[model samples]
Target: MSGENETVTYRVEDHVAVITLNRPEQRNALNFDAYDRLERAFRQAVRDPDARCVIVTGADPAFCSGDDVREIMAGPKPAIPPPPTVRHAPTPAAMAALECDKPVIAAVNGAAVGWGMELALYADIRIASEKAKFAELFIKRGLTCDVGGFYRLPAIVGPAKAAELLFTGDVIDADEALRIGLVREVAPHAELMDRARALAARIACNPPLALRYMKEGLRRAAYGDPRELGGWAIETIRTLMKTEDHREGVASFLEKRAPVFTGR
Candidate 1:
């Protein structure tokens, strides 16, 4: 899928699919072309059976600089704004990773600002390098967080922390990211990709069906009232009880052996 999409390069390694943002010359900015191309790349991952998870990161010093401002301002600003919503969705390619039953992890290799941060937000998990820096950046530019950042950040870091970040548009490092629960872990700059792949591999080894339900359960909990979450949790557990992996897991515990799961 490398040459198939000009703005994004899709690759699979050990069942961990990755969509690398490749426009370093432009700081991997979310140009319209990038958006359109990424939509395709993500859908490709959705159709890949061998892939149970994915990682998205940039090729160089910046994960993304957000939408290409030069491109957007290249034309007149729309008299009417898009309103408060996820800017990159409705395109199946961009929404694919978010809606995918499989997990998606973001490896924030470097600076992530503006919509770039939102791209990471859409992932199920986040891992970043110490060198990684993040900021909402919308307010700084006389705009609001029109992308998914406003919605996703609070869910990851809680409402207060998310408000602080958005209100100040302050840049934060990896340590702060970990403190706020925005990222699962942080690694040295040189080890960022290795760590991200390792985490993805771990999630990939879990039973795919159970993992899918687990992800759904979490998303459901995040988006709704407590009663809905209670019902979903019960149903998910019931479904998992019927899987071969669950039987193996219990037996392995009883037999004092490591469970060998084939994502059944």
Candidate 2:
């Protein structure tokens, strides 16, 4: 079965559901609409009883370049109402991926930076293409990442390396990511999906119930409660968004210049 919308696509084959972020022209950079579609795609995967595993990949040339900075971050600030009293609501897309019962793999085909890297971290495992690159780019934008960075990155790549990536916003090539244990394997760019699907097929051959429980067990044993971390991340990002540094960061990126940060 296969289906597609403007920004996301879903297909199921051999008990594996594949979700593609579908904006190659834009390097799969997400807007609000893409985020909603991504959430829905993961939910659909979870609801499909035949789907024992899931693979998320982006179109050619990029995995996901992060948010569409032009659309999401370039505009003048709008006045907003206060958030509701609910203190621990994760973003819909992140929550959906995190809560998915099926084993999830990120097939990182190319650039996976900023929230793109966070998306990869949300997966149970990541398989990268030789062309893939990863980064925690939020600091360069004077923002913090969603919960995936804080909750999963440290566990995957060690606290010190995670701190360096998060603090410097430096990009890492696929081999570097592999060396740091950020990806399980790196395939030739042409074979990326084939490699991911082969791995997913092996995983899907397991008993569904066992796989689900095993995934959940690992998450519970290895990580802190994401809800609490998510709440804190959201609040910190909101505060940072209002700062002069954030504004300058956005402006400089749009202008293709170096960002001048002021500790305002």
Candidate 3:
């Protein structure tokens, strides 16, 4: 970690990896450094065998404030993105986390806007604090949200609601987040992380391979045509059935005792 050490930090406990956005003073606003750190951290988490699940949250009050406009203005600003023929589109870190074998839970502690809200949308589950506020505020800034926001939101909340949120850029609090099916639960600010951690721990206690299969199965099923995707799913299910964890899961169910999976 360089001077960007304050950008993002990764920590692991009880088989749960937590990635925290650390620039609370800036409302954890992201720039190049934060994006780079996030991409790197997600890649590392994907490869870490010790990680059974992940929880993403902020280090301080706000979960994130989206992009840092001041930094963008000071830097070389492209008036508008040039033709797609020239540059490749950037990949979102949240997508990387979502596609990983381990499940992710987002602990939304405070304000989550634009890219920040997109990041939370990537998680398998979201738990927001009572003070948490969410908005897809790209319209307010005269920008458009990236892939995670555009694709995941509609899928999560259906077309009409997603359109309402994105098109208007209205701020929504935790209760609305739950009503719209955006958050799993809303807790007091102090208990948000603990609730997230407890959920992660429960998921971690399960057979890791089963969890992986479950996650992968659902992901592929989303927007996947059964005609073509069914083949891959068949192979995937066949492979999962042969794993030691699969056998352990069956035996554990019969024995009425928890399974001790070794991630095999």
Candidate 4:
């Protein structure tokens, strides 16, 4: 099975669903519509009985560069007090991947920064290309990270290392990531997808029900409730979005200048 939308492409091969972020021109940075499409793609994979495992990757030259800052940050902002809502969750795409029953592998072919790193964190396993790079850049943007950064990073690479990455917003290469135990394997750039597919095939051969239960069991036993964490992250981000420092962060990036934060 194969299908595609404007920003994402979906296909299933040998009981493994492959979802690729297709906005390579923007380094697959997601805008609002892209986020919606990505969420739907994950849900589609979940509903497809043929899909026993899922691989999430991005177009060549980059994995995901995080949010489309120009569209998301430079555009006219929404009111600070958003309209009342019944529920709070991470971005739809992040939440969908977090809840996906099938095992997910992130094949990081290039840069995965900011929300892109969060996307990688949502995966059960990660395989990186030699060209891959990662960073938790929310601090540089004067905002807190999403649920993945807060919930999964520490668990994957220990609390102290997680704090170092998050606080500094430093970009780390594939070798460093592997050394920190952030990725299971690093393949040659040209062989990244093939390596990821091979791993997916191994996982897909397992009993689907058992796989699902094992994933759920792992989450329950290891990570605490994502809902509670998500609520805190979202609320904190909302507040930060309204801060002068965040405005400056976006402006400085756009202007290619160092930000002058007032600690406002």
Candidate 5:
């Protein structure tokens, strides 16, 4: 079904809920509003009994370029308040994809950077287009990995490889991602979605209840308590938000120039 907001759209076909990130003009870069809508879409897929599998992909030319840096920088800042005794809870949006027990696939047709990369990681399987690229770009933004990247990336790509990508914030082509096990398969750009749907259909043919239980078992085996890691990531990002490096990162990004970091 088409979403109320155009930033994200959802539809079900042959037992697969196909969710598309729709902001191609900005390379599907998300702001807070888009993120909220995406979370809702994921939740809807989970609740739909007929959706045995879910496929997430973006509009042509980009999957998602992470958060909209311009929007983040230009948005009004909230007033600082005293810290509460309890730690801040993670946002539901961050965990929405993972909360689904049914199989989920990422049809990475183009650039998937930062949060986009994390979103793809949340999927049980990833099918990439030859034109696709992947990156963990939070370091360049002077931010820690968010949206479960720290918990998921190492599990998918191994700890050492994950560190290199996370530290350098380097972009890798689809072939590189495939070689490193970040994606299960890569197809030509024109045929990426068809490949993803075929895979989703194959999985959907299995007993749905058994598939759900198997998915939960696999997840439990693969991930630790995400709550602790997610909490730490959030707090680290909060601290980074106040840093001079982060401010410079945003300013340099907006100005289209190299950022001069002082290690502040």
Candidate 6:
């Protein structure tokens, strides 16, 4: 099932819905259209009776580099102001992968930065290539973490490590990610997808109903109540979006220079 846009592609093989991020030229950095398409693809996979598991990967050389800086910052500003409802409600795309009842496995082939790393965190299991790199780069954009990163990262890698990553926005190699339990296994670049599919197939073999129930149970155990934290995160992100530091961050990024944050 291909997406409305070619930016994302979804196909089923051996009961696994393999969703590929297709924009390798931008390192699969998602623009608004790609984000919407990705969310739809995940929702489709969840609803597809034939797909018992879902595997997300990118077209070689990169998994996802997070948002397209140019698209977000360099694009022309809107002439009309956004309505109040738009400002208050967070986008559902950020949590679409997590909302899926079937298991999600991220095959991190290469760089997974910012929301890219956050996307992997949403997965029930993650498998990375030896060449894979991960980062929580929201700070670099003068933005707070979105896409459920604030809620999921701490649980997967522990609070201290998660804080360090989020605060510094440092990139970590696959070995470091594996050591910290961010990924279950790391394979050679060529075998990354193969390993992911093997695991997906194993899970797909299980009874679909049982898998769904197990996923729900685990979700409840890990996240007792997501509402309060999720609300705070969305509001904080909205506040940060209007800051001068964020504009500077985006400008510096496009100009290939360092950002001078004023803490505004």
Each prediction's TM-score against the native?
0.76, 0.95, 0.78, 0.96, 0.94, 0.93
Per-residue C-alpha lDDT of model 3 across residues 2-64, encoded as one tens digit per residue: 234669888888899998998988888888778778877777778888989998898678998
lDDT (C-alpha) at residue 98 in model 4 = 91
Error of 3 at 94 (Å): 4.1
Inter-residue clash pairs, candidate 6: none
Model 4 Cα shift for residue 74 (angstroms): 1.1
Question: What are the Cα lDDT values of the candidates?
Answer: 0.73, 0.89, 0.75, 0.90, 0.85, 0.85
lDDT (tens digit, per residue) of candidate 5 on 58-118: 9988998888887764457421122354355344566688788889999999999988998
What ranges in model 1 sit over 4 Å off? 76-94, 224-264
Q: Ten residues in a row with the worst lDDT in model 3?
A: 224-233
**Backbone clashes counted, model 1:** 1
Measured by TM-score, how close is model 3 to the native structure? 0.78
Give me candidate 1's TM-score against the actual structure: 0.76
Clashing pairs in 5: 1-10, 1-11
Task: Show how many residue pairs clash in every candidate, following the order shown.
Answer: 1, 0, 0, 0, 2, 0
- Per-residue accuracy of model 6 over 103-214 as CA lDDT, tens digit each: 9999999999977898888789999999999999989888888746777889999999999999999999999999999999989999998899999999999999999999
- For residues 1-264, could you state the per-residue lDDT of candidate 2 as single tens digits? 244446999888999999999999999998877887999999999899989999999988999999889887875533112346656756778888998988999999999998899999999999999999999999998998889889999999999999999999999999999999999999999999999999999999999999999998998999856988887887788788899999899899999999999887
Global lDDT of model 6: 0.85
Whichever of 5 and 6 has more TM-score, that candidate is: 5
How should the candidates be ordered by lDDT, best one leading?
Answer: 4, 2, 5, 6, 3, 1
Best by TM-score: 4
Give the winner by TM-score: 3 or 4: 4
